[model samples]
Target chain A: METDLGLWAVPIAMLGGAIRVSTPILFVSLGETLTERSGRINLGLEGTLVFGAMSGYALAVMTGSPWLGVIAAAITGALFGLVHGLICSLPKVNDIAIGIAMMLLGMGLAFYFGKPFIQPVAPDLPAIPLGWWSDLPQVRAALQVNVLFLIGLVAAGVLWWMLKATKIGLTLRVVGDSTDAARALGLTPSLVRTLATAAGGAFAGIGGAYLSLYYPGSWNEGISSGQGLMAVALVIFARWNPIACVGAAMLFGAAGALGPALQTIGVSSGYYLFYAAPYVLTLGVLIATSSPTQALSGAPGELSINK
Target chain B: MTLPKFSRRTFLSTSAALAAGAAFGPLPARAAGGMTVGFIYVGPKDDFGYNQAHAEGAAAVAAMDGVTIVEEENVAETTDVQKSMESMINFDGASLIFPTSFGYFDPHVLEVAPKYPDVRFEHAAGLWTEGMPSNIGSYFGYIGMGQYLNGITAGHMTASKKIGFVAAKPIPQVLLNINSFLLGARAVDPSITCQVIFTGEWSLAVKEAEATNALADAGCDVITCHVDGPKVVMETAAGRGCYICGYHADQSPLAPEKYLTGAEWNWAGVYPKMVQTMLDGGTIPNFLRGGLADGFVKMSPLGPAVTDAARTQFEATKAEIMKGGFQVIKGPLKDNKGNEIAGAGEGFAEDDIRLESMDYLVEGVIGATS
Candidate 1:
């Protein structure tokens, strides 16, 4: 019997928790990285993410296939992004303000439509059991990483490579660095930025899918919490790098898992305080790395936040 | 049906009427025609948890002949709830209102209850103290008794003798439940220990899921929680093949096979009785409280997995609670920190007011309050 795990369970639990917790954040932050790289930011990804979760869960429950639900979430997320992109591309529209409005709209719609699906059970995303050789059940459980997390890892690497070596990535960078420069080079900045933002929304939608179909795996109004909004800060902390987003997301995941992991071994006195670890880690990293005099390194020149 | 909307003109006129009523001593209680009762929830009504329990109550009340129930869901604990209360009073002409969420009591209910002295305000959980508005009343059930019952069932069902509790916050109410659960389990098997994890938010599904998995990973064969929405916790624990003991509402539908039993609020029985009292030209009690005997709380039917021994023990303990003066917290008790909770020859009874300010997990529970 593995009833008395003692202190050894904390690290193993935290490791499993990190992968589970970080997957959604990683997806959203990577999506935001793509959008921010093109000189536009979709703060509305929070709304899109939540909306995606609802749509994904509802679809998965209907289709009886988790993969179909993921696809449905991606499509809906892209549509939300398209709406954000189309509105932001208009003259005198503030993407930030529109993002807030879209967030409220998305949440409102989800709450209204999601009322029916709260009780129905949806099929969950599969996990790959990597701890086959381990005799300990804790080790086996910890190593059962979800497939979406593995996909997030590959997506991060691919996004990083595309941003550095692809022509499409170069067009995005050119449009993001200078609208006039891109226009002179016969590239339409608005069209490129809109597509990039939509693609980013697709990624965030996938993150939302991971949330409802895996880890906490249920359809409810409070499912996302502030994971969507947190990804915005995460993008900044990652310095707009997809690869860095994965690391930062895991840091947050580990912090989130810390309190619960300690409780397993009876270090639970101040367990509630541990939930704040992620936010504190984010604030600490932001202060330690940011300087008042310099523009943030690797920041998109035409990004609205920079302006 | 939609709750009556407050137009700008209606708001101004209602404000004037309220101001005038405040100065003119008190408006006469409206006892004519059908009465409007407003119910406000901090989350969606179908959340399958705390709000759902109250919503079920409201649904029962709605079926009454002369009662018109108006409900607004997803009302936050901020001034937004105050606005909802005022709207229910003004636009909907609600004579009595139930701001059911606990957070709505402190400033939201206290702030709004005084402004409308004629309308009755009932809050869930007995937070009403003297010098607060007389119009505002409090009512709650001793659901800890239900948790203790759940603990008895869990203790018998657990092969590993490790029960897990996923709670939200370390408040007195939650701590009391944790202590009672451990105590009940100890009654069955003295060596059984409860591992508790507080997720901090009432409805943070991700953390609740993580906590459940963590408990299951640590070899807890049975799991329960005090979170507002137990859907995620129940589903996750059942997914990992752990026996689930639900809270706030009946969750057997979520985990049919692995569910042991649950602690559920019987607001359906309590709410209508209170409404009927007011409807019959009677004053409702300001500090109404009860347990299984009074129908304030009820336990879910024992699951198919429950043993005959567990069922016998659960029914016996429940009868004791219903018989009244049943002391879950007794003499010679210590918290998880090895500090005394109840010294020898001293203990808090089932309805002890002192238990409301509980600040420690009892001995045999693996958790801390701070």
Candidate 2:
């Protein structure tokens, strides 16, 4: 589909692709928000994303209900994170390597479960046609959004408030900023962080399920185009703020949509190079904003990745 | 429309129950416990390629007597394949299981088969996976026949003398296809070159598109893909104003302009026959490689762009194969190195091609394996 960028359609396509792109990131970054605030990092969300896509798509096809498939996916993802949490709960297993192993295991599982779902039309997700609000033809095209996209927006706001205002959030942050501080205050660092990781894992699973159950329903080995890992990268760019994560996720979305947008507008040259927009934008953003001292900048203390 | 969020998409319920030829077949369940069949696919059924074909086959079975099928797409790796298998057997109560990927043969199907001796497993692509639960069988189409015929078209149509072939992985089955396609392409134009690109993974649209564009830039006018998804070779070809033959399905929509033609596996026609065979109290033969004659495989509709000469030639080649008169790797075949393949009318045995764990490339195809 050659998106005509000059006809005011390019922006519409970008707006549409932006939401499509942001959904996966919203889920992953939200999960990361929970993780980073709780003093841990599950760098294995990429694997979780793949596995969730596979499992969710497969299960949805099997049961004939995409929602059940989603639930099944969430459960699988939580279990995956639980394993990560349990592994990290013990001493000496680097959460990074364990995350890596979990990633492999998650991807492995997704591939296996996804076998039969390779066929059949997945039940399509319902979209809210907010385009009706605008009589402009372009607005209609631009505003054809999924309910989950809106839910993601709300989720970002609620999560942001939770981190800033809730006691659990404060405690988790305490444990994250300084396990010693939490311990001095009689708080359990291990418990708070473990729960956060599990929550993050669940969100990652939902991110995965979103890919299969919504934008492109049904299972396939190639269903996920690295949305999970990109979400993780997006979290770093979001500076651990769930609200900002949405904007960052959408920027990445716009970048990804640029290639198709350019091709859509009758300028098809260098089309292959357009696929690199997200990575290029991502690199540009990180270089522009990242503080030289990881700790001196937006990074939370006690996160294993910074160290 | 507050599109009430429902979780899954259900194809028509499969009311399928068939008699079991083998002793370990499904015991006739009560009116409620009819036949339950399970399927494992390599990609989402909606992928419109490999898994979708098999799912349609399974759905066809569901359309028949007393069968209830539960299909799972996007099964992760072998371990999870085994998990999905086990769950189908123990939990979903599937009497028959089809793991539609060749990769799932050993680690997944074989590992789970012995545990459920009462259940039968029909696996795709496991020439070796034929043994299991005394009831397991393997099925494959002679797709090499279609690939060879498509080659006749490729050879006849290409003016640039260059053909591009994109593939997913270098497994033996895929390797055989590349060999057959090249062999056919060379049959018509001996000077024709087939440049191959490996996407490393299956059905990845972006990578497929990128690699395809690079090939097109190098002046390859004719293209083909063993990979899944319309987002790749088909779309890229249409956008770049090139021609391509599709695999697995009639992907003409993606490249209506450049659609050259493709080979499609008629699992719908082939699968019901297998179910009937099981019901008729007959055991499936080992190493069953079904083809056009057997109705497991068929050629897709030629696209508008495929010339009459090309179609006519391909049709003739296809007819010969259906008659069991054509052999791809038969003697007078020379290696790309100009060495005699078997020397003076010697042919590659079914073991060499059928058990075909081939690594060598035929003449006219160029690429390297890292």
Query: Model 1 over residues B1-370: C-alpha lDDT tens digits?
Result: 5667755545785887678677864433233478889999998888879999999999999998888899999898898898898878876679899999989998889988877899999999879988899998899999998999999999899889999999998898999899888888999999999999888888899899889988988899899999888999999999888899989999999879999999999999999999999989999989889988999999999999999999999988887887889999998988777888888888787689998988888888887766
Per-model fnat list: 0.84, 0.16
Q: Could you report the DockQ of all the candidates, in the order they appear?
A: 0.70, 0.10
Model 1 DockQ reads 0.70
TM-score, predicted candidate 1 vs. hidden true structure:
0.95
Sliding window of 10 residues with minimal summed lDDT for model 1 chain B: B24-33
Off by over 4 Å in 2: A1-221, A225-227, A230-307, B1-34, B129-133, B228-231, B334-340, B348-355
TM-scores, all models, native as reference: 0.95, 0.60
Clashing pairs in 1: none
On TM-score, the leading prediction is 1
Go through the candidates in order and give each one's C-alpha lDDT: 0.89, 0.72
Candidate 2 lDDT over residue span A161-270, tens digit each: 98899997789889888889999999988888888888898888888887777654445566566777778878888889999998998887766666545443444445
Candidate 1 regions with alpha-carbon error over 4 angstroms: A291-293, B1-32
